[model samples]
Target: MSTEERPPKRPRNDYGSSDASGPPALQRSTDYWFDDGNIILQVESTQFRLAKSVLAMHSSVFRDMFSLPLPQDEPLVDGCPVVILCGDRSEDWTHLLAAVFPLQLFRTRNPTLDQLSAILRLSKKYDIPLPRSDCVRRLKCEFPTTLAEHDQLDTGWMHIEIPGDLSITQALVHLVNLAREVGLFSILPLLLYDIIIAAEPGENDHDNPNVLHHALRKLSTADEIACLRFHVRLMQPYHQTPLKWIESVPCVECTAAPKCSVKIDLLLGLALNAPNALIHEFLTQWDSHDDWSSKVCEKCLIVAKAVHETARQKFWDRLPSFFELPEWEELRKMDFE
Candidate 1:
């Protein structure tokens, strides 16, 4: 009688169990639910039915997990034990599984940024060496330690061949976070410099719409601060070394002092007025306009190129320091290890 209106009894299912307390319904993955699979890997509401032996062969973590004795009352679907993968995304699992079981055996394919990222994360988590090593190798190819390899990159800094919907700016932001997550510190200086250059108002505006705003919103606060600091700290070396020719008088063997002096002044103006001057590779010869080579005397041109090369090498050597990273050799060692 004193039973106040019991909260409307929770709805019951066909089995007469309350819906609120019953197990959540799972959706079998369309691609990964194999008829002969021996294990169910559930992430959230989706389940992947895969071969335990295959997974164990590839991943030490999985091998060890499978070696453990299961409880007598362990949940089973289609006679296979269910292993819920906590703190993992179904999409990431799909990527890793797809890589594990390729449609064409040994056929090389370049993964999109999203696919690569998912594979990298999951492979690292499960201690799958092959995929992890391949991902690291690809990343190093894109963001190499040596300046020579870097110089070979004609496409701008975010040139990792991300083939999909992900824009360059988005890929850059993702790569910045991913590199840190995976301990690829060697690539950060160049990557951060690219981000800083992209965030500069004019450089990123027309080509990459809203890049500045996107980067500001997406980048970690520490990375943002690092970029700001690098921008400020780089100015002294940027001006003093790479662009130091701006302050110098013409060469002693001056063939045309007035003309060479005027050219140097013009070069100085261009360097100063550049939107991303702090990160600009001033030593790089502009293919479209070699004004220094065309306008300056041969002797002066030779001297300028030499000075720029030496200065830029010094700048490159010190690049990792700007971002508070270890030297290039140390960073490279970390990557290999």
Candidate 2:
């Protein structure tokens, strides 16, 4: 049998080798060499495109600006297409409100609560934004019974996009805490608490939305009614009520809380000057009634005095007392140094 001379070593597909444009490690299955031989690899459509644009225009001006380009492959869309990262759904009232964007990633149109929740699950699994409209519409309509399974907080319309730095879980906890204090119902807060408890031993990476969802579902069986009652009672200590007050009052542009309000200065003073011991103690038991006057020196007291005088107190009281303090906030801030 004349061994058919192995079809002239089938001239290698141009994609088999790395070039300036192609990622060396793209799964060989998807790799293909174009006739022009300009190697290009697909990455997540949006970010990779963004990166490519930036690279084509500004790469030379800024040394190593786009060192690691994101993969630009067609999004995997079986049950739902999942992207692989999120920017913590940062917010501004004038900008896209935080709650609305994530669900749009799954579908450009409406999504129900369940679909939104499923999208969130996919976001956690693959590390993408939960902004898909399909996901949100799905979640809102289904009210995702599965959401109760996540460890991340679902306070209001919030979610844990990232895990650690402004994570979805943190957002959920904040929403729950805010709701508890603001009276949006413990439904969200209780949901967060259940998940926080449930995400046991899982790294607080904020990167893992699946684990976050897994923990949150524990709320389905939780005593939410009781927790709501407790929070209702808890509100009395501050003489404040629900978010309805703020919601009812249009969040109009008010120069009242300017970015550099004097309170911020006081906080900076505290961070730079206060005794670390005092700062640490205050944050450790922020909710407790430990008197700052007892630990803080006269200098910190001066900052505290300024802090008490600012309009920031209203917003401050909403957060934990330790966080409310200028010294604590100042110290905690990344730009403090």
Candidate 3:
């Protein structure tokens, strides 16, 4: 099988084996938690967020100094840090607030193995000590999934370990929404494109076609199509939603033909029901995009069109001395018409 087709999650290596009980209680005093093959430095509530910010800035600085282009597929590789320092009993809580502000202030340096070991030791020693739920809860958000149900969690990370044909794509779809939820655009380009958490903000109270038109144009190639699995594909109309029972689809004969006559959309291969916005965006974007190809493989026409050379190169020339791509400056003035 192609590398692209491998299962999304590899075997969980939560510190050599799935001993869900975790390291012996005394080992909890170890400053870090090693699980799922990553060493995380623990930080108390105040320190964890600060550390995450510091890490992000540090990563960005490294990116600029290296002058590397964004990874075409995944976000720039991020090293696992020792867990952020969630406090323990010996660590004084009253004075710790001062430290929290400082830690949350910026992305932090990667903690050493010793630091991580210390955090893990705390977790093992006492189930709850300093920092309280508020602090840990915030730190926990950094991770996509929580450690609550799992054996050993890289609590400040997002991860999925699933096996399937399109697990990566499925993960991407989920990640995109997560990114948008946090207001980050283009985490990593859809180079390997396993998912798209396509979104259009706000509800459609009036069902305006102009709103639809604009949404159609937002049909960037980045949107994920998991939505199609929940809503019936355009061709085979089914009443999956309340509106489906009342709202008739437009022009059934020519434009509305469906793909894969099966009414149940198993393509997602996921148990999730697609949200309304995601479902609509996928259908609109997929069906109407200039990139839409009419062939067996469903390749997009974007590669042929993105570099509208005559138009693009002209813009590329007039930009600030150090610039790339077609410059927006000239293109705005030249009315292609």
Best by TM-score: 1
**Tens digit of lDDT per residue, candidate 3, span 1-337?**
7889977863333323445464321222222222332223333322121243333333443234235443445221134433333345334422232322343656344332223223333322332223223232322333212112222334223322233453333444444453333222323222111122222324543455243233323333334232332122322322332213111221123232244212113422221343434333221222243322332121112321222222223322321122112233342233111
Q: Residues 1-337, candidate 1, lDDT per residue (tens digit)?
A: 3559557654423323335656655688999999999999988668899999999999999999999999997767789998989999988888788888888877555777877888888888888888777778878778777777877776643423575676666777889899888777787877877776656656446677555566756788888777778766656544565766545448888788999898778777776666365455543543324655786887787776677777778878987887788899988778632
Candidate 1's error at 30, in angstroms?
1.3
* TM values, all candidates: 0.84, 0.22, 0.19
Q: Which regions of candidate 3 are displaced past 4 Å?
A: 1-169, 187-337
Residue by residue across 1-337, what tens digits does model 2's lDDT show?
3559545442322434545664343322112222332223233222111223322342242224334553565333322222333432211110221233233545343433233344344333333332333333332232222222322323344432323445444444444443333222313423433433334334354476466345344333333344433333433421132211211111233233333234444543554453221212211222232443333444444444344333233432333221222232332332100
Q: Tell me model 3's lDDT, rounded to 2 decimals.
A: 0.30
Ranking by lDDT: 1, 2, 3
Worst 10 residues of 2 by lDDT: 89-98
Better of 2 and 3 by lDDT: 2
| Angstrom error at residue 215, model 2 | 6.5
Top-down TM-score ranking: 1, 2, 3
Candidate 3 clash figure, as a count: 54
Model 2 lDDT at residue 13? 22
